[model samples]
Target: MSARLYVGLMSGTSMDGIDCALARCDERGTTLLATYEHPIPPATKQRIVEISRPGDNEIERMGALDRELGHLFAKATLSLLSKEQVPSTEICAIGSHGQTIRHHPPSSHQPSEQGFTLQIGDPNTIAQSTGITTVADFRRRDIAVGGEGAPLAPAFHAAAFAKAGHTRAIVNIGGIANVSLLHSEGQVLGFDTGPGNTLLDHWINRQLGQAYDKDGQWSAAGSIRPDLLARLLEHDYLSQSGPRSTGKEVFNLAWLDECLADLSSPATPQEVQSTLAEFSAESIARGIAQCEVPVSEVYVCGGGARNSDLMRRLAAKLGTATLETTASLGIEPEWVEAAAFAWLAWRSMAQLAGNIPAVTGAQEEVILGGIYPGARPRTQ
Candidate 1:
């Protein structure tokens, strides 16, 4: 089979922007061709944050925002295609990892409830606007068959990074960090490693009115509060075994404030940010240590990979293991997640399983996402 063009669209927990990646994939492998970041206005981001938590008139807000995002995504896709001078008709499909608003895992606090996740961006609107087959709503099917319905990037990490005799780990630090442990013996295991940039970003945003602590500069200027770091580390979620996952729902401002309330003395904003950075690094290191077999190399990806101070903290925590970005493997750190979704779309079109049962605790491997045919589609 020949490689076909596919575009993957992602709006992560940060709500910073939408990542759009263009890739060509076939039986041989996948290649990253180009990429784009579509900005999200402050108003849109605030509304998204509001919708993430409970509030009145949610359905109305959610409905309008969902369609709004769809249009945004389509515009971004078309913009990318135009820049590359590639017509929509030449594209095979679009894999959209729409913004995740709420994620309730079965393993977490919600025991009796069937775990569910909601990522809203109308795929129908995307397909209609872009004239490309769209594959979306990728998490629910995994949840339906007894899974966390998350950490979907592990499946892609295994495919793209794993080698026959090398045991490696791929850690993607978005709002929520997730680690993929690829055993040399061919088994893939992983789970979310607590809050990634969620605490750090939110803390800085509140204190200095900055979008984020660029390169971890603000946190670097502060001192780590030992008592506070210890308190954050004691979180119950850290002890949970695999097949587990989490989201902002459990690690938001409320949770952070609750932790702060337990402190002996009030912490300065910078100190709190410093403690949160260490807390993020520790949770990630602890998660990797849980791998049944030791990981020889640690490959980092996502927005957090660009934070020098966080990377230094992680290096010390992960001592001896080689630390580097996915760029070593040909894909830039920022593009990995978007590329993964594009790869997943190709898998869906091929009727191949995209979820790893062992990694997600699914009953079996299954092809993820629902397919929305393009404007010109009639035959499969």
Candidate 2:
């Protein structure tokens, strides 16, 4: 079959914005066409965060936000199409990861109860609004088959980064950090490493009222509080086995407070921020070591890649010969995850299996996502 164009839309745990990327994909490989980032309005972001945790009217509020975000996602898709002058009809489908509010895979929770994961942003709405086929809800089947239903990016990473002679690790530092280990032998391994920018971003924003510690400059100005770092590292999650996954449920600000309360000196705001940065770097390095793979190089992506201090710390801790962004490999760092979704959508359309059984612990390979149709032909 000929290559098809697809749009992948992702709103990661950071809750910053929607990322849309246009990809031309076929069985051989996928190529990037154009990409765009659409920031979520403050009101929308506030509503989503508020509804993330349960309350009296949470379900109702969540339903409303789901549709709202779906529309926002559609707006992003349409805007990207307009900017690139690519007709919506020319795209095969849109693969939307949606905004994950809660992701408790069956393996992590009790089997008697529904092993549920919720991503708010209706694919149906995205289809209707954009007049393009949309494929989403990409996590359920893996859960049904006893998988962790996450770290799905590894399948996509393998497609893009795997080479016959080089082993590469793709680390995505979004709200959570996950690593996709690409082996020279064509095997892929991946899992959530631990807290990425989520905790650090939250603590810094709470203390300084800024969105994030820009390029980690604030953290670089301060020193890592060793005592606090030691205490935070004691969490068993750092030592947990792979094929594992985690979310805000485990590493939120509340969890941070428990560690902070045990500290001797009340760390200064900058000190705490610096410690958080150290914590992220420490946890990631530990996770990489646990992989038992001969990691020669590390390619960082997601928001944290911009944090110079975090990158420096990771480099020092891992002792890898070279460290750089996915851009170093010719793929834009910001668009990696977005491109993954587009590739996943293309896989779903082709009825091809997209999830790696080894990474997600699924019983077998499975085609991922539900489809939403577009109004016109998806090619020029």
Candidate 3:
């Protein structure tokens, strides 16, 4: 089979910036050829945080950000290609996951119509600016067909990381953590485990005026408070089972404050951050443990893979299972998600099913995303 190039753009829940990747995708799978991290301006990130919830002038704020974000995505794509010295003409397509501001999957078995998700970086702008077919709005099609429309990367994980005769769980610790269970017997499952780094990120940002904990050094310095950990673990989201998804909407600062208020004693800022780390590790480990198959190895990816303290906590809880990053599978931890969107773009262009029904709780398999045609290359 002939291999073709594709680009993937993802900002994720962290809003750190855009992660743009150029990949070579074929029938077997996609290989990340190069990656670039384009930082989002502080003010733009702040606007994203505010609009994540609700605020006055919502339409106007979102409207402006939508166009601006598209330009950023376009620029990121061009920069990555330039860094690799690859021509846009060589790429088959671009998959832009955009920035997710709100995600509300139906709480129950209500019709898919009841749930909606919004990820806003304009594909039209990308198609026009980059001169490559763009596939965006990847989730809504799955949602329309009664799917959770998330953890989409699990399908890619099963192909790239799954080991024959070994049950491995891929835990993606973004702002919200989700797991992909690849059983030894050929069954795959996935769901959101609960909070990931969002709570710790928010808690630390509130106390220290920093963007992030920088490898979780602050949390490592403080002791994990038992009471706070217990209180956080009691959340209803963590207790749920089966195909599910979550985002900043459900796990944010306000909810964190409410949990703190329920604590009998006030937990110091650093203590809260420490407990949040344990909180994330426990939830992720618990989710992996609850799956039908016994997981033999656990691979950590996304932003949390870089956190040494979080990795230590996760390793302690995994017991006998091995804990490692996606790098062991030939791709870097941070690049995994972006690589997924690139694979998805390949699937989209080929008119193939991208979502796994078993993982997403979708009624049936469907081709995800809408494509926008790009300007044809001039014949020279």
lDDT of each: 0.89, 0.87, 0.87
lDDT of 2 by residue, 316-362 (tens): 98775478899987788888999999999999999999888899888
Per-prediction TM-score to the true structure, in the order listed: 0.97, 0.96, 0.96
lDDT (Cα) of model 1: 0.89
When 2 and 3 are scored with lDDT, the better candidate is: 3
Worst lDDT 10-window in candidate 3: 105-114
Predicted candidate 1 versus true structure: per-residue lDDT over 356-378, tens digit per residue: 87878899888899999989632
Give per-residue CA lDDT, model 3, range 1-380, as digits (tens). Answer: 12399998989888877998888898867778899999898888988888888889999999989998888898889888878878788989999999998898765445544888899988988888888899999998888888888879999888888888999999999889989999997788998888888888887878997767889899899898998888888888888877888888888888888988998889888888888999999999999998786788999999999999999999999989999998888999999899999999999999999999887778999999999998764221
Give residue 288's lDDT in candidate 3 (0 to 100).
Answer: 94
Q: Candidate 2 local accuracy as lDDT?
A: 0.87
Per-prediction count of colliding residue pairs?
0, 12, 0
